[model samples]
Target chain A: MIKFSINKAFFLQALNATKRAISSKNAIPILSSLKIEVNSQSITLTGSNGQISIENTISAKEENAGLLVTSSGAILLEANFFINIVSSLPDITLDFEEIDQHQVVLNSGKSEITLKGKDVEQYPRLQEVGTNNPLILETKLLKTIISETAFAASTQESRPILTGIHLVLTNHKEFKAVATDSHRMSQRKLTLDHSSDNFDVVIPSRSLREFAAVFTDDIESVEVFFSSSQILFRSEYISFYTRLLEGNYPDTDRLLVNNFETEVVFNTNALRYAMERAHLISNATQNGTVKLEVINNQVTAHVNSPEVGKVNEELDTESLSGNDLTISFNPTYLIEALKALKSETVTIRFISPIRPFTLIPSDDNENFIQLITPVRTN
Target chain B: MIKFSINKAFFLQALNATKRAISSKNAIPILSSLKIEVNSQSITLTGSNGQISIENTISAKEENAGLLVTSSGAILLEANFFINIVSSLPDITLDFEEIDQHQVVLNSGKSEITLKGKDVEQYPRLQEVGTNNPLILETKLLKTIISETAFAASTQESRPILTGIHLVLTNHKEFKAVATDSHRMSQRKLTLDHSSDNFDVVIPSRSLREFAAVFTDDIESVEVFFSSSQILFRSEYISFYTRLLEGNYPDTDRLLVNNFETEVVFNTNALRYAMERAHLISNATQNGTVKLEVINNQVTAHVNSPEVGKVNEELDTESLSGNDLTISFNPTYLIEALKALKSETVTIRFISPIRPFTLIPSDDNENFIQLITPVRTN
Candidate 1:
């Protein structure tokens, strides 16, 4: 039996964090339950959906937790139903007690709720990732890296390997993260002050995104551990675990372009607005395309759909050089790349009208770059 | 040629108001376009989807409109496309000009867009609602009345008459609006200061809800006019028109019960909170029912869902008299009825466990009342 009283607000927050990993539809009935274990000093809540699991612990030592435990035990309850009940409780503090096997009662003010609990033994045990050698990084830096590269990952299951972001640590000093969907690629590299064994792993893009969303500003840094088939991202009060994709990532080093016949510089905001307007028309056409033309020092972007009319705009370019060229490509790829760059000014280098192009921040080093393959418009 | 220059923000607002009536799919091709008529003094934009139509006019006399008409003419443009183009323009002001018989050009900053225009003569004429005698009421009052009675109307189409709210002006003095869906009913009555023609009509609940949404606080009063098959609500700068439902509304006067064996008074907000909590569990069950018991002047609300558990709460009642009783009902109906009441304290009078009950504001005159039928659970 388990019995405890805790602050409503504090418990609700913990439940929400763990709820992110709980999918509504569960292949295993017990997987839809949330496992809650209470000890003399703390309470832990765990929720899992097979692919990903989240666990949050609130320590009694923390003044705001307001935790009082009469006994120590573990139990499981329906995830969504329990959360809603807690959310609708009327008082500041709620008392929980397990009077019999598979029976639990909750009292908050004049409201009393009784729920059927599942057996804790029925839940799958959480996979353990070895923490012998952990990689430590700033939470904000990790969030930024995920945002910059994850969007390029393929969403289709046909190429399962491309649906994951590749992370590699080389020479125990350099770290890099890359994602690509054949048509576009994003790479981010950074130097580390301290590292352990060099390893390479592919984490599913969806799992990485979820991990980044759960990271709050108060979590200054996170520790990551990798096993053969599982990865864990751990903070002070939370642990996030996900299964690693079992496949080799494609070699993307040779895909980066160096030689260029045409180059242009543009204000990020100005170019984005023009692309958005052109997208309005191109988006309506079948296999729509937005074309860009460079003449002398002026550049113009235009989209023509016979049925919906046409739109043309003079781009606000910062500078231009090399041979003047005209190129047509999918506008959506460039728009998303620009948003991820988060820069004031961007530099674009093109090899040919048909070759892939590269975009980099004009004010920073080339450590971060994105590549987009142009469409062959004849 | 139709040519004009106007402030972008002012024009966008007008387009949005008119766009509310334009449906994505239209039986008549021309109905997908918005008609624009510009004279020397004003420009009117109209959009219709057969059932309802909305028109907004911008006058040159309004300083903020910044309307500078180069010429007076009329034309039609695809509603959604034109709205999106105007929204994406970069400058504060946009210039529009008709270059040919079926083509138009819009210039804003460095962006130029050309769109195909349709003949304005192909668009259906706006049905006129004679202004010979108009009944005027405060916009706020009309909004309140719509909210108070519209939710009780039936959403199902099998009974067409119940899907509309019956509005009647008796002897050109008393104004009453009532709606019922067989299981529940809401009625609101008021007196008009000045008299007009006595008439009765049934307006579709959906149209009134949409018309109410477009009314802003700036519109102090609305003038309403009724025709044989249509009704129009007109303000100084905007007009909304909708077709009336053709059917005889069922008489609901006999459904209102005046005597009861049990009476209970409760604070509206406190009871609503309890009901919401009870609804959480009852909502999960098939054909869920929430049961309320009154005994010795104390009330308890409970819901028992075998699979999801049960919740019981002691309600904070203001007063109780008469007899003890227990009743079961569909919580959704009561929840919605309470929301529409918007009262501080409500008095609930029950005739019996199986008979419908009435709720009225305990502190104010009985001008607004809502009745709910009980669910029979043996």
Candidate 2:
């Protein structure tokens, strides 16, 4: 028999954390529901699609914790139904009890709901990543890095490995992440405080997003475990797993250049907002081109569509040097890269109008670099 | 020449109101833009999609009124581009100047944008509903009646006239609005404060929504005019016109019946919330089926899907009377109708399990009656 009075907050958190594993249209029948194992001290909920699995636990502790399990048992509930019902319940203590091991009932105040359940025997077993010591990392830094670079990954299947965020740990101290879709690329690097074996792995960008979403604000640290076939992330309240991409990642070190023919410096907000106005007319069929004309002390943005008319914005710049250059590019790529920048001002270096340009945050941003190829307007 | 210094708020309101008449993918080139005419007292803006035309004029009055046109002239500006640029400008005064008869410039603070213009001579003129005195109706009441009945109209085109809301004025005082899609029907009536001659017409539901959107909170009454081909709604700031449906509407007086074999009275919110929970498992293929079982003093909502499992809940009721009847329905139909009800307590009267039911608001509901046919669950 299983019975418990769980606080609404904890139950809702666990349900939402595990929901990323439940797809709207799960092709696998067994993957459409979640498994809940109840015990005297705590309760564990696990949800999984074929590619990833997430397990969350609510412990009985603190002055007034969210859960209290009296008896121990296990059962399966349809994920979508369980999520909707729990979300719509009143904001108070909720009582959950199992009857005959095949059904469940929930009650709060004047409302009581009974839902049919399935035995946990049919739930597929999750693979274990072994209990040996795993590499520990700060959850906040990892989450930030993922947000900075994962968006640059290729969404097309032509090059499967390019769809993953490649992580490289050199001599167990220097950790770097790189993502590219051939046209534009973003990379961020950091020095890990804890030492470990040298490792390189490419995790699919889609899985990284789901893994990152389950991190709570209170979860400062996470233990990372690695197998030949998959990567696992274990935290105090949650465990996440993701499939590894097969094949070698391209070496992007050669693409990072330190020299330039012309360089322009401008406040990130000023340039970004100006581009947005120019973007009103710079849509895709028109090549999404926004021309930047660097002359004297200003950089003017010009966008002209044959059908929609023209837009011109002269943006204020700090300094414009070297051979005056006029270049164009898809404004969307530069806008996103600039938005990810952490500095108030940014330096953009160009090598003629045909070669790719590099964006560097003024002395403030620590270890991230972005590059974009200019679209030829001439 | 048209030269004016206008504030951003007034300009935004006029642009958005007219945008509703401009389709995103209009085949006609002229229909994609808005016509702006400037005068000393007011500025007029017009947008039309051929099917519907909306004219909004901003007058100089009251504190911080929307417009103060300085000169007299007219031109057409691309709706999407103009709206986007004006919306992004800072909250301050903006200057508009016509130049060379074929171009216009907008200047605000440090930004100046030049856009090409079209001559008003080529613009299509809207058909006038004549200068004869039009009927006056309370904007709130008309909006309320439309909301209650328009949703029941058929969205499909098999029967063109059923997609309209039929309005009838009997004895020059009582006005009734009725809409039906064969499966369900809704009717609402009220006595006009200002008496008029007998009138009846069917207006397409799509056009009624656009006409209602132009109403402002301060405007209590709107003058309505009718022509053989169109209906016109004129307020202090806006004028809206729409084409009338060209067919005779079905007479629905015989469908309204009195007396019933079973009836249930409960708070509208209580039943609506319970049905929403039951909806998690109810959907169209299963007929969007949710069964309501009425007992001595309780009503239980039950939904069972073989693939997704079952859900059952007992709802609180004020009173349950007559023979016990178990009726099932497409919860969406009943939910929408109940949401439109204005009273706290709602009484549902049923003739039989297979017959249609009438929904009447307890005490506060005025002049509105909704009907829904129960789906036979075999």
Model 1 — TM-score against the truth?
Answer: 0.98
Candidate 1 error regions (>4 Å): none
lDDT (0 to 1) per candidate: 0.90, 0.83
lDDT of 2 by residue, B107-198 (tens): 77556667788999878988878736678998888898888898999999999999999999899899999999988899998888878867
Cα miss at B109, model 1 (Å)? 0.8
User: Among the candidates, what TM-score does chain A have in each?
Assistant: 0.98, 0.94
* Clash count for each candidate, listed in order shown: 0, 1
Residue A258, candidate 2: C-alpha displacement in angstroms: 2.2
The lDDT, on a scale of 0 to 1, for candidate 1 is 0.90
Candidate 2 RMSD to the real structure: 3.2
